[model samples]
Target: MRLPIPTLALIASILSVVTAKSSTGDRVLVVLESGIEKGDYSKFWKSLEARGYSLTFKSPKDDTAELIKYGERKYDHLIMYAPGQKTFSPALSPQSILHAQLDGLNTLYLLSPSLSPLNRDTFREYDLEFTDSSAGNTLISPFSSLASDPSSPLIFPAHSPLLSSSPANPVLSPSTLSGGPIVFPEAISHFAGETPYGFPILGAPRGSYVGGSGGNSNSTAGEGRKGGEVVLAGKMAGVVSAFQTRDNVRIGFVGSGKALSDKVWEASVEDQEGVTHRTANAAFAQDLTSWVFQETGVLRVECATHWSKTGGEVEKAEYRKNEEVAYSVSITQYSPSSGTYIPLVTPPSDLQLEFTMLDPFVRTPLILNSTASSAQGSTTYSASFRAPDRHGVFKFVVEYWRPGYTYLRSSTTTAVVPLRHDEHKRFITGAYPFYGATVSVSVAFVLFCGMWLGMGEERGRKKAE
Candidate 1:
């Protein structure tokens, strides 16, 4: 008997609630400025929805815009598009949003030149410092022929020295190099501090600088201008960047909200050669969100185990010193298109496993074991080596960190106990010389005793005579 239509619809809804499109989760809360409508970012929103994300839009000051309820996060991701808004509802305060991120919410901040002080400070916490938006410090590229004025929004060539994409990074597709130039309309550039957890997705053009229309970045502005400083210039500026927390939560920073808007999505851009082409913002934005929302470059450790190769024991908590040991871990990466985790067919060449005790005693590469990876949706990595001769507590650690991928970490502790006295071998083949020497000494003693006894008996017969 087939289920009714209503029943089917209910089942679908239930499944949607339980299953997440992004590896992190699917619920997204987009906090828009008061005057801004969700329609302003319709294309961006629609793309996310197409990937099965449920978006909830609210004004910055809306009292109902609560990110957390009863100490539980109601959403898995957040989009803060209120660049000009200075005040937010209590529930959506900067502290609260940060708290939500700490609770595992991925956040995307779309900023404007008139960035609010609150937002600037919040971004500073991530080691990002934006140009003074109030001073009209928009990034300008002199090489772009598209803009009539020197200070007009800059257009950058899609690839290389002009605008570099982190293709090695999963945040942008490899096809981005062949795509059209990206347009930065009224863009606000920023300086990113050195951080291991952060990386730039799109770098500023080579000639771009934060200054007025006619000023040379290297020279001081004329008379009375004692301190005319160029905040950032050249590749020092960041157009877009991302940060990943230790927990694998992601946060993205876009210099201009308009970059992802429908206007830019449907617009065209011109390169330095005056060749006009469609904008690459749509594809770039999609790839950016795909990473920031954990749709791609997401990794999961399916299983990890260690065992004694000599004893044929699996996952034993203890092992004898100098024992031949084996370790294996299975991992998978999420595929947004299929909404499932698939095996990372080509394992990272640098992936390593460390058997450490305070310091690593054995550091070896985790070679892909195709035969052991017969299970679906995971790739198994294995390594075999002898345990350290010294007996002590040690941990098997796997730390895999790349720019765009989720940081994978797995640690298992085990003890290496000394062999028991009874566990020692009774005889050894390598001591043949000592064994022969003992036999020779025993024969010599027996012969000496027989001669002494014979001599004593002969003396006794003489005394009787």
Candidate 2:
């Protein structure tokens, strides 16, 4: 007998739910303020769901709030939407969270002015800071596409990436429908040699300000927050920033709690001309989350090796000054579509190799390796150069850093020495004059000695007679 339409529909729905539940990808932990029911933010959760994330939500005060289990992280990422949360479970202390990131836990965060000490410490460990609101915790800008009052919540026309280093900005239509700047000029210590990687990727328009007054006013704005003076806004300020650890773990932050809130996320606006367009919040959410979860701009160094140029074979520390040598490295990056870190066969032109002792002795481009020079079909970058004529401990150093991509660093040291006595050439073309002069002097001395001895013997014979 054929199944009824209702029964078939029910079965299909059950299967779809099971499939979603069983999906395998980055496991996400979401901490939110209580009293805000989960269903209220269905759109935001669904946005992440469409990106292959398995989400788990909890209150900071959840009795069983846990992140790590037995030295292993239980979740791959954290989304904190609770700005006023007074406390967090002990497992989320700065030290534990820092360690989790060291072991690779990406994060997405939004902070409020009422920062708890625990949350503050967490941000500090990652070399990041949220902008302070001097006027009030909230921002109201005169440059509005939505509200007419300058002191009311402002809507920004998001265009152009914060920096050329940022990924290309998404295209928007209707021209007048713009994006809003999330409050705060967050500062990120993006330079290397600090805690994980951190930098700004999105920016707010100039002249935006913090509204409301009579609270803590000791906060300084960060990079990209400019325009409104008196401390809250400056010349240039960033609204969104990102970071990543050496382990390829990542973190993203948006200053406004409502940046993706249900109310403003679906922005539809009309002007006097009656044309309508959506705001950039949706595009920004996709881009930011993808980056936070390692879906965008992720790279890895698989392995590196160096070998003597004579036979192209690798062994322990053995090299000679002025000898030819070759160096190669394999690289790959995350491909969201394939769900793998695929080989980066064609890298940028600036990719290079540094043969260094103290300063660089050889700096040259690393080109794609020939199939014979590398593992067959490997995505390897290779280069060859003669070792410096001088001898000391040298290294095969590859440091490839570019904007919007993970930094790549690899250094391998090798011992180098002058040629051995036997290995020295009997004659050098460039030293022919010196060798000729020395040989000529030696032969003349021997001839002079022979002449002197003969003269002495003749003189003695004459005196005896």
Candidate 3:
């Protein structure tokens, strides 16, 4: 009797699963507070689990709440689901989040529908402000599908490559949307103060104000009245705000949690051409996750320059033909975690150098000479080559471009020319025949003049006699 295909598939699947688990170690730690609804995250958690991550959930009330634990050590990620308590202490405060980040842990924090009494001093320390105001409200634009159906409790604006399609634009045409969720705050503001590392993720619709009673108020009110109107009648808007601290810690502020609801997570938006589609919250969530996970591309050096050791104090503006010179270059890489710059190296080695003019004259692989104090960590390329005999404005150039690394470009020009006034050989062996001919002519003339004088004297004596 032949075995059933289902049984055979099940065995194969189990074997594959075992093999995957043995090779991969991925885990997540979710910290949810009391009373917050677990909406689309449930689906997301399942997806993560399916991707071979072990998901663990905890609350601030748990005995181990203060401790972030993983398989052998601590969690690789921390998901904060809006704590309702008054204050998150140092052990549970935002500093804890920073600590986790310092340890290379990724974090995601969601905004709560209701404001918690917790004083976000830590966030304030980073120049972020969260507030509650009656003046804050969402607006539906004629451009959005939500505007067409005011009664639709769950409305998705449009599909965005940067965001999932379920949540579409409510004001601009869905086609104009690039990111997910235009978060309009009833009243919210973030001031960067001395440091402006915080980048705005969304802005208010055109002609929107942040304060006031949200009614018709002219601009020419009394001084006190104007101030009051500005404070109380202006509109507030922000979809998501993010900041990177001097220490390289990133924090994102979300104004509305309803946008990430379970139903919205499953909703998708179709492109205008109808060629592509994306879920509203899914795309946004994916992008946000990628950013928080530090997977986004960071800074890279595009280029650099270096001078030669013997290029003189002025750095040799030009080079002459047959002149020998040396040059070096340095390229670097950017690290988002430490927010520091690091030097780049060749594959089998740490650094490389080149000597070039128009085309590379010398392509030499450099080896780090730690024994040499001048080149301890640096790779030096040194060589002596005569400039091409051709006379022209030629440059000594080194151009280096590495993937995910800074680019290096360096050049020095030396004007090479045919032998100069003092450069030519004083006497030419090939002109010996011409030199001898000229000398012989001068001697013959001198001899002829002397003989003519003697002949004159002799003729005078004969006349006297």
Candidate 4:
């Protein structure tokens, strides 16, 4: 029997809602200066809605509203969009925001400098610092012929491969959208961060610093700055900065609020030749949102297990050195483009696995196992190796790190031991020659003992005679 058309349509609508709810569970908290539709940031909110996010709004002054409560996160992501405000609601204190991030909330922060503004103590904890004084620098590049001026450092080669690239460099676009390099006219210049926490992911071009109160960073290590980053050091500053918390939660810094505004994000300008193109801002916004919200670059270790090949024991936590062990794990990546978690990534991103102790005893590349399912959204990679002759505790570890993806790490340990004395067989087929030689020596010794006893008895009889 076929279903009626009306009934089918109703079913489809319900299914669609269910799918959206399940694909991405990103509950977003957008703290702004005012109401959503009442503000000039309607377009920014629209871009997020397009990505299937459920959003809640809180004004900078709405301290009574809780961003989180009762040790349970009310939201999965947070966007601090009110840059010009002098202060925020009590709920948005540095401690509260940091705790939310620790609870796995990815946050995007937009900052601007003004005298006597609210202190950004939250950013400082993440190592993002801003001086009280303003900058005389422009984030422009002098080398690019496309630079309409010396200040817009976001200029890329007109024919640069990034323009037509897919996935938009994570800050550029989701995989489903096309993206080019991003540029903003009014970027706030700041000093760079150091290793791990302070690594600069984006930069201004060379020959581009106009020092003022926040003068040329004494950090001019490379690209004209001292004690600063080598590759990230450009003329005056780094435009967009990002870092991942130990929980794999991401945090990104956008230099200006105007850069995310509707006009700038979608603006297309004409050059001297009348060639027109849109700013990469729109795609950048989408991509950055996806990344910070855990919609993109997410990795999960669904399964990790090992078993002895000879014993066929997956449950055994101990094994003998002679046994060959099979190690495998099921890993999946959250695809923001498709809005679902999948095992394999397009263009074949690599996943690395290590078998180790103090050092890697068996280091080998993992091959994608036969067990992969598109429906289930998981990929299995596996390897087999003989247990080392040395006896001790050993572990299987997998660490997968990519520029745009969340870091993935997991481990499982097992004990390897030598065979007990009683476990050894009395005789062995492989040592037949040694066994036979031992038997022959023992028989000869018995015969020799019997002959010596007879000789002793005969000597005693002769003495009595």
Candidate 5:
């Protein structure tokens, strides 16, 4: 028998809930200030949901404010959008942020007018500092332009392959909206003294500064007059900045909240809604969120070595001049899923090996051998070439760089010397004529001496008789 309409509806609702739950396998926790406009991120967040991300909303007042528990990451991603006073509760202290990072949770900090409170001395332990200063101002360009009209809403440009690769998909189409001019009252500045692993995604041109009337009284300059002279100047200057940890946790900071406001997203010049430009903003948000959520790819070279084949090991200290030497290099790439390193095929083609004394003697490209295999799953590059005729000191070098890969450099030094006295051949094709002439002269002199001695002996015998 067919079920009643109420029963059918209930079954459908249950199925829908199950599907929704399945769709969001990973959770994205968003921490917002009590009364901020969060609708600006709606489209961006929906885009992320479409890509299989589950989102959670919370505030500093939540009973469970801390993002980590029992040394485990509670959320895959943490987004702070326009936080206000006491935004992060005491439980979510700087230690909590550090722990979450250590646990590999990604973070994205969105800025607004009231970000100063969060940047207080209490949070400095987390490697983030917020200043009321505004001297740091600069603009970035997208990889390409997005404006339909010559004079339309502008969007920020981001062409770095790192931003587009893997977990971070720089939304190119949506960034077109960022082509128009963007005006800012204050710009966030990142300092020079940051963690070695921290990378700046966007920044102002060096020496550029935001000029404003009021200086930040709360800021401390290294060795200058009070705040206004250059409250936020130098290396860091951008509305948005990003940093990455050694463990790959990413933290993004947007200096101003209005940068992502719906009014800004929907704003148009001459009453024409610039949807194309709008797409860029949405794409930027989506890309950054994806990066924080661990959807991007990170490639690193584990090992690079070069050696001669004769000894079956890396070449030793020296080689004879013009000696034929075989060279090879082995490398491995990292895989997060396997939790083990694996050999890489098609290692970058640009890897160059050079035999140089002072200048290069033989500079040649290394070709990876697809036919060769090893337990490491790595491909080997091999070549055989004679050492340079003239050599004192020579080195083999390889420099490899690709869009999203860490650089690889390999070099080995070996001394090459000329032939020793006994090492030279007794006779050579080029010296045959000289050898023949010397032999002829030696024979003639021997015969002449024998004849002269015989004649002298005969004369002496005759005189005695």
Candidate 6:
């Protein structure tokens, strides 16, 4: 039997609420390598589904898996797990992927040691340079590896120095950081250039090095030679990295696909010291996906207002020079658990505001308004300062950039006009001296003229006598 119209509408609303997981959108495209089964990373897939994402799996050879259509993104996010595949669909080309990201599609890229030239060039565009694959470069660490075999995978212990993180980094939550070690197999070392948009998520251990011979070698990266040279060592090596465009498009690069495999998620790792540790791969994978999918570290400016403190006027089109002004902006951060934007209780201490013309005239920190923030599910940051003495078209700009978080930028423009003639002071203390001098000069000139006329009259009377 056909459902009633009202019932159908109700069902559709429920479905919409259920699928709204990501702050951006819920549509995800998973591009898999040929012959790879979906069950290979079942846990990862399930987690995405649980979070309400609608995933579409496609092979690299599938022509129908287009990321863009009619100059718009078909999917909100793209997951390319087909590492080491030499060929890809034309719609998924490197340039195409880059353009899709520009169109606001977040992406995740899993890579292998053997990178095709196309992949290399693509990553290079993001300032990520991997070790030379032709030289048989493999990341090896005797102390961190499971065994003496050069082919053995490496393990990062709890709070491993190799896993670089910051409190501000949303990619690794506090629980994940304090959790079990991560098992990294078939690790390919790479280097990240100095780019503000990109940063390394995982660094190589102190003694780890990438060289041609994947064997136990004591030589550092500088001393390696012969058939294979060490291309990266220590902190210079990175296994995982991330890039976020200015438009808030996020991209993640994992050097090894096995790291996200179900087998690795359940596997335990033992270092050379014979200490066994549970794998945090599952947690790491979730966090990575959560971030790239815009489920975490997402921020939105709800509203911003500026007004003259003295006049109590808000959102005026123009402001007078030297007026005390107050600016406040409401910001909300996306919460995956609630599936909504919530107040940012603890905003960054460095959140700042700048009043700018050609250059910044006023720069100050934006303080949190606790009462206002608690009322709504958003944080309100406000700053009060005197408008610059110089008058011109000025902008109230707030630029908050932190790694693993969305770049927050808000700019509001208003003209700062010179004071009106009636607004000018009737008397200026600094001009008192000039005023007194003018009056004295006038009086002296009048007395001189009177004396000259009196002398001329006396001379004329003497001549008549």
lDDT of 3 by residue, 395-434 (tens): 5555443221122445555555666788778889999999
TM-score of each: 0.86, 0.73, 0.47, 0.75, 0.52, 0.84
Model 1, residue pairs in steric clash: none
| lDDT per residue (tens digit) for residues 1-465 in model 4 | 999999999887755434442123668888776423335667878767755777888787887657678878888788887666676667886667777788877788875433123545555666765443333333434443133643444543232222343232443444323444456555555565554643444455555443431344433323443323222235336656777876777888876555677766667754334456566777667666766677666777888888888876565698787678888788887665455667756423366667777887877677777544444568878778888888888888888765555567879998888988887778789999998899999999999999999998999999988
Model 1, which residues run further than 4 Å from truth?
Answer: 1-20, 35-37, 133-135, 149-167, 214-227, 428-432, 447-465
Per-prediction count of colliding residue pairs? 0, 12, 36, 11, 20, 0
Q: Alpha carbon lDDT of residue 252, candidate 3? A: 56
Q: For this target, which candidate reaches the highest TM-score against the unseen true structure? A: 1
Model 5 lDDT on a 0 to 1 scale = 0.54
On a 0 to 100 scale, what is the lDDT of residue 373 in model 3?
Answer: 17
| Runs of candidate 4 exceeding 4 Å displacement | 1-24, 34-38, 113-121, 131-153, 157-181, 197-201, 210-236, 271-275, 337-339, 347-350, 356-361, 370-377, 425-434, 442-465
**lDDT of the candidates, in the order given:** 0.79, 0.62, 0.46, 0.63, 0.54, 0.81
Which candidate model has the greater TM-score, 5 or 6?
A: 6
Error of 1 at 165 (Å): 11
lDDT (10s digit) by residue, model 2, range 1-465: 999999999887655433332112479988887745677667888877865577988887775656778877888888877666666677765566677777877778865555565665567666755444444444444454343333323334344343444333211222322443332222211111234366655444455544333333333433223322334452334455666666556777666655576655656544224445455566566666766776666677788988887865865476888888888788776666555666663456568999999999999999876573345334688898998988899888998655456678899999889888899888789999998999999999999999999999999999998
Write the residue-wise lDDT of candidate 1 on 1-465 in tens digits: 999999999888766534547877889999989756678788988878866899998888888888889998899999999988999899889998889889999999998777888888888999989888323567766665244543434443354321332335566676765677666676778898988887777767777777544243333322224335556777888878889999888999988787887877857755556667788778778777888899878988988999989767567999999999999999998876667888884567678999999999999999988887776558999998899999999999999988878899999999999989999878788998999899999999999999999999999999999
CA shift of 355, model 5, Å? 16
Better of 1 and 2 by lDDT: 1
When 2 and 5 are scored with TM-score, the better candidate is 2
Worst 10 residues of 5 by lDDT: 137-146
Better of 3 and 6 by TM-score: 6
